[model samples]
Target: MRAPRPRAILAVLGVLLLTACGTAGATDGAERATEERVVRVAAAADLKFALEEVADLVAEEHPDVRLDLTYGSSGTFVQQITNGAPFDLYLSADRGYAEQLVDAGLAAPEDLFSYAVGRLVLWTPDGSALDPAPGLTVLAPEDAGTVAIANPEHAPYGRAAVAALRAAGLEEQVRPRLVLGENVAQAAEFVRSGNAQAGVVALSLVLADPLRGHGRWVEVPVDSYPRLDQGGVVLSGAADLGAARAVREVLLGAGGTEVLERYGFSLPGS
Candidate 1:
């Protein structure tokens, strides 16, 4: 081919550079479009079933947002968040814990909202000879073996279990037979796995599918323990505040309220 003039070659080079830049920009835009919005949630173990359902509903509406949930004792989560854990939101079984975050300036006071009221249940695996009904008096039987409860020091459900036992005057009799789980969910597991003959767990957990028909439960009288006013708050250090708030709404809105109710949770103020 004949050599091109200097101007012609310069013009071609400029076009090539512009095309490369355009292609690069398009690629960057595509990458940004596909980037997922992640919301890290620190939730109480009692909320495992209900929150998972809420997450599914949230996904249906906000596919770009991914909810990353960490379930554990509410007290433990409070400690973690206070120490600057990168969680985007906190859902506590005890409302007080979420309030504590606000007091510490880790979360906005206005962002805190009560989501549900948890109830305690006395649960025993199916086919168990023990009858949890009538009351905690069943624990007095000689063959009761062990009763599993979450660690009262950190798990809100555990505290309620203790309170119920005390109210029923069974604390002394059941004290020696107690086996502590790290959280309420683990306490339910202890009973399911036959490690403990019976347990006191969140009513929401008992109403969940796998456990709902797998065992027998008696609702502990509400008067037996302090009400479990569950609360949630958006964290101050959230990577995406809007996304975090969106997830929070999913738990507090109609869809979440229905799911929570289906799982045996009573809505706050209901």
Candidate 2:
């Protein structure tokens, strides 16, 4: 076979080198690509802005990790999680849902913990003629054509809103004027859009920049309603428990606490 030509030998060597280089480059690329692990989070609508801020901070330290948050009413989130929603973490605005998940064998109680103490508030758009004093009486019929609140059946914040009104002895006077929102954030929206004279919403919702620029708020007396203890847990089917745990830590960590505090949330027991 003429012992193979010299050119053929060179060609074979070139192919081998190119193949080795390509493999090396591919390996390097893979290593550099963000090892982002998707951690699906079922969060309360009230937590929309606060959680996003925490997620951004987490991304700074964990460029390879990303939080996929599904924001809605706490009860709705609980139902979805029970139905096997693709979530690695659950952050409810109230403890009831998290406790329910634990009791239902859907979440591991050992992994569950309170993340924040949800706060409620009365919010109104700029220049609105509403006074949000503690234990304030309901406005006259003509003064409050509508007062917004989330649907109590599915939103923890909504329940809190009702509780506050009841505590203030305004429920009977205000119930007929109540405008139901799908979530606390939506209740805030009802005020922001001038659809309601005033609204009860999560303090975080009104504290968030978007709403802050459009309105003013006053903290509802903490004593008026049951404590809103928000909690979270790692899902049973998490593909990356480590990532989920990291996110949980970030939410419970000092940095996370600061972020929450900045947005009107308080640390558990604080």
Candidate 3:
């Protein structure tokens, strides 16, 4: 072959250089695009705000893991989980529900993690004539308009609300005007929307952003109802058990504890 012309050689070299640079850039981009694994979670409605904050903390530490949460009543969740729902984690409002899963063979006992002890609150809209200062007895009047509470059949908070009402000797009066929500959050919404004059809901819900400044709340006496020690479990069928375990540790870690405490949940030791 004849000796290549100088300009042609330089052009060939330039094309090769450009091709190499493009390849390097592509490789770098691929390396930076880390894949995140999704963990499906079924959490109690009482954990709506706190769990969201905990999930944010989980994201910060484990960029490779992501949580997709579904919130509802713990009892209902227990039934769903028993029926083989595809949730990676089940965070219940009552730890007993988690234990039930363990007993039912749906979850291993070692996988259960206690998250927090939940509190119930009596909430009233800001300008409403009703005041929760009088405690559960505030709903005793026949003309108290309407009272909202979670259904005791499924929601832990609902059972607590009913207990508190009964303890206060107001069950008869309150039950007559009670509006049962599917979950504690929904009961708070009933109060927020003015559908009910008063609500018996999770302290966390009333303390969360949406209801924080718009309503007034009084904590229900802890002795009136069973202690709502909340807990969760990594499902036996979790797609990413490692990720599920990592998320569990995040909840037990300081950041998650702070978020839970800030939302009115009591720590196990505290």
Q: Please, what is the TM-score per model?
A: 0.94, 0.89, 0.88
- Give the per-residue lDDT of model 1 (tens digit) for 171-251: 988989999999999999999999999999999999987788887889999999999999989988999999999998887
Which pairs clash in the backbone of model 2?
Answer: 36-64
What's model 2's TM-score?
0.89
Whole-model lDDT, candidate 1?
Answer: 0.92
Off by over 4 Å in 3: 1-33
Candidate 1 positional error at 139, Å: 0.8
Write the residue-wise lDDT of candidate 3 on 1-270 in tens digits: 899999999999999999999999999898767767899999999888888889889999998899999999999999998898889999998888999999998888899888899998889997899878878776777887899999899999999989888888888877889999999989988999999999989999988888888978899999998898898898888998999999999999999899999999998865
lDDT of 3: 0.90
Off by over 4 Å in 2: 1-33, 140-142
- Alpha-carbon error at 64 in model 3, in Å? 1.1
| 1-270: candidate 2 lDDT, tens digit per residue | 569999999999999999999999999999877567999988889888988889998898787899988888889988887888888888888877888988898778787888889888887777776766632464545566688999999998899889988988788888888999988888888888899988888888887888876766678899999999888878777888899999998888888999999998888888
